[model samples]
Target: MFSDNREQLSRSSTFKLLLYFLACIGMIYTVFVHQVYLSSDTFHRKQLDRELSQETEIFTALAGIGNIDAIRTLIAEKQSIASPFTYHIQPISTQTASLSYPAALTGDQPYFELSDLKSGSSLLLDDDTILRIEINRDLLQKYREDLAPMMISGVALPVIVMIAGAVWFAVNIIQKLQRVNFAMNRVLCGEKNVKLAVSRNDDEFDILSIHLNFMIEQIEKKEASLKALTVGVAHDLRTPMARMKLRIESLLALTSNNQQQQELEACHDDLELLLGMFNGLLEIANLNSGKQLISKQRVDLTTVAQDAVDFLQPLAEEKQQQLILRQDAAHQLDGEPSLLFRAVINLIENAIKYTPEEGRIVVVIDAFGIVVIDNGEGISDLDKLQVCEPMYRADKSRSQSGSGLGLSLVDAVMKRHGGELVLRDNSPGLRARLYFN
Candidate 1:
């Protein structure tokens, strides 16, 4: 099955951008929550200290002129109120009436110690009376209860919005890219006029579509120009070449000199070679330009392989070589018979040309594809890739009699049939595979 997940995460800029956005949002949430928590802590601590300072001054004033009893009475009256701070007098009374006390308290500065407030100061009277005030317990829990929901909402709302936006953006971009890929595939499959629809927004995808459409147009123009030029040159040369051959033959008949006849024969052979080259070029151009009409029907590839083997058997016999066909399976495909025949012929001919005398050649028809193998010196790794290009021949095959257009023509034919021609090492020789899609 075709999958887009790997492509989206690894290749899509939109997906990567959304991931970065989410990362940044998370970082901001963490920093904002930390700072806000600290600010709330400082504000509550300052308020507590201010209240403690005010209460200390009031008690000292009430205990003026050595009136310890009055100070005690004043403390007893204030303890009746429900306040965050709970005050107590030790060595004087068991306890004051208060709902609860701060669980931890230390120092006269009224600092928090594990949810409790502890502070104490001595009152100077005629005798001695020390008043100790300690605040403790549940302060931290109460603060957290108030701050938790507010802090959570502050971060959660934006995070939710960002996540939704990221999903929406990634989906939209993927859909647009899929459409573009579909259009490009059509073009690659030989639809020269196919073009993607450019969006009005002029986004990155739109720009890419514009460039791709332009590239396709350039390719079409170049191919059309090349085909026209090849056709014109081939047409222009055919008649002159024909007339020259006829004239040379006529001259040979009239001349009685043996040397003159030999020269004329050489000229005739050269003219025939030139004609053959032109014909090959014209055929390649026609196949690549899609000018030749192809009537695709059910073609039995095993039969094709057998026919090619039969035709090349005489040539192989002349050189004392073996040419065999092994049909493991009979496969049928939709293609033009003549073109497919030409492709198989080119492969068999190439093998025959390269293979030495008494060499073995086999044409195998299997479920995978059609493969032509020869027990000869295999093509070099460097030459294998360039062998399908027009006029490209390996250095080892330089002296061989060929137009060097045979493999190029076969490559063109395979592509027209929605297939590929792959060249690989055949252990001791070369293996040419024609794969159908």
Candidate 2:
């Protein structure tokens, strides 16, 4: 289940959109951090440089006035106040002759390492003395620590909120699409009354729903018209065909010549075929239109399969085929007894008609349905799908004698019972199953 769900999420457009959104957010955050780091470093460096430059200028001016004592006094004041600047004064007369300005300040060593001196400045005094000043690194460190939390919260809060909103939006869109998909599936399953609900919010989804409903309405009208036309034509032709059959039977009775009698018998058989085809067409149309209601009762599927097998056994034996039934127990379900019987009969009849001589046929009855398997010339994979359609004959079955309405009628009956007719390749033959819910 976990793997299935992960695969589904990987295929979902919403998940892909979410990943894209996160990637974009990450990129923006990275750029923001880069810019913030550069700006902060530049600002702190400039502040440090200004502090060192100002200190050096003050000491150099004091030296220019030849006031070494004043410089020493000012250094002492800075040391007393615990200033962050350190000063070093050295005379040109002797290389090592340097005054620490404030001896305690020189020993204080405010910086941890040479790198800690963020900015430094030096000036040569008129008295041949050098003045040097260095700014403390603690000021920049403190500033960074203070700004760190603000920068994090500034980006973190918005990112979290945007992600939440994106997820909600993606879920909402997916749910709406699912609704439309479900309705479309129902329509594909022959539920012409199914329609997508419109929220009337005038959004894109609402507009889509409205258009789909209109399209369904148009399809329902056209389908009803076509079904009515087919039913009407078949109904009209069946009556005339029955009259023709009666007249042909009378002529057969009146004929005395053997050749004419044989010809009349052939005409009678053609009429019977036509009548059967028309009847099938009308029955299918009625079932599709819901005009033929199914009265459901407790039905024994095993009995149904046995009856179908028994009824068609002679036909199978005529071809030297072996017809068998495999039923372990009584499988009962709620369905129309006559319709289920007819469906079983149609499947078994098709097997007998298509199987070659000396072939084997088996009708297996189970809890959910019955499977009719045959070891004959099987239908191709592509033909299996089209064979269930009315009047559709596979190339292999074209030479066989059938009206091609057997599977179509069985399919309609299965649908009327809220079941399905599934066709499979039985390796060397066809496996036709009528499943009941």
Candidate 3:
């Protein structure tokens, strides 16, 4: 069966976060264990010293009394302690001995001792039983066995707590990130209004969610713009193209020579204007469509601007328009060389077309981007949206200057680079900025 059965088994962001927490917990656990071992070792050593101290006190007190029966009485009356130890007294003046030990020791009654515990267990004193009360180290062996479990529990409990705490924190953060992930996935599934349900905080994730949502909003705007372009392109392309065909046929039917010549010239102008409009539409369509792949490469913006200015000088001079190229900053961009040049040229051309004769037009690069400014009557804000539609002109009757496809081409080029071309009004003219990110 064609199924993604294991897909869900793959770790969620939650699981991954939990795993990371577990890893950190594991590291902390190792350190805790080391400290526990060190503590246990130190405690066990102190316990051994404690056993020897009690033995010394008891043995000394008995020797001071100097009576065999008194030593027996002391052993019988002494209370048992947490540390494992045994007391055995032997009269050494004669060759007689006695032994006693706790039930925890290993022997017939789980304990064993020699009459002279001094000689039976020699690990500690090394046969130095002369003129001193002697003791055995069987007590020390039992001490380790008694304290082992308590020491293990001390280290184990904290490890459990550390892991639990790590898991708790991991689960909380993972839940937040998962919400954002789902929101984005919903957007891809045609859910336009989906939003990351992030709580208000100044954390890095919160900042990321904000920026990501902002980007989604921008993408929504561009998608809407492209949808509107279809209707706009159809309307703009049909009108003048329809007019040219009608105007030409009628002019061809005229018989008077001078009148025919004048009519024919008008017809030629309309056809030329129609052709220019189609060419601009074609340029924009090719750029936006998947059909024409741009041969993109790194390009020096300085050289590109200079070339565009040089190429447009003659056209600018024809209309007594001055094309001023100003470089405020150097830009290195990546795109098809020809397309970039054409887009920039169209921008300059649009400015030249709208500005009055001998009016100033400036083309400059800046930190913001490349800008084309002109001292012409600027477009109103309401009409700016209509400007990028192929062959769209607000004042369609006045066809003395623009075929109205210049801005359309510029918009397409900018959109392809994940950038924008904004037509903002200068106080007395139009200011166009082309941003390349």
Q: Give the winner by TM-score.
A: 2
The TM-score obtained by model 2 is 0.79
Expressed as tens digits, the lDDT of each residue in 1-437 for candidate 3 is 11321233234555466667767877777677767766876786666556656565555544444444665565566534332444543333333233223233232222222223322231111121212333335655565566666666766776677666655665556567668888888887546766665557778888888888898999888876975585477557767776776677676666558877777778777777766666666667777664568778998777877898998888889888888889898888777788888888888877777788888888998766688899997898878868787668866577657777777888888888778888888999999998877
Model 3: residues >4 Å from true position, as ranges?
1-265, 396-400
By TM-score: ranked, best first: 2, 1, 3
Would you list the C-alpha lDDT of every candidate in the order shown?
0.78, 0.79, 0.67
List model 2 lDDT by residue over 1-437, tens digit each.
Answer: 55754565567788788879787987799689768977987887787777766776677666555576888889889978867776666564543343322222122232111112345655444335555566655756777777787777777787788777766676667678879999999987667588788885999999999999999999999987987888898999999999999999999999999999999999999999999999999888788668997888998898888888888888998999999999855678888888889999998888888788899999998876899999877788778758877888885536878878988999989989888998888788988888777
**Candidate 2 structure lDDT:** 0.79
Residue 405's lDDT in candidate 3? 75
In the predicted model 3, the residue pairs found to clash are 98-115, 105-110
Superposition error at 383 for model 2 (Å)? 4.9
Write down the TM-score of every candidate.
0.73, 0.79, 0.42
How big is the positional error of residue 148 in model 3, measured in Å on the Cα after superposition?
Answer: 65
Looking at candidate 1, the ten consecutive residues that score lowest on lDDT are 108-117
The predicted structure with the larger lDDT, 2 or 3, is 2
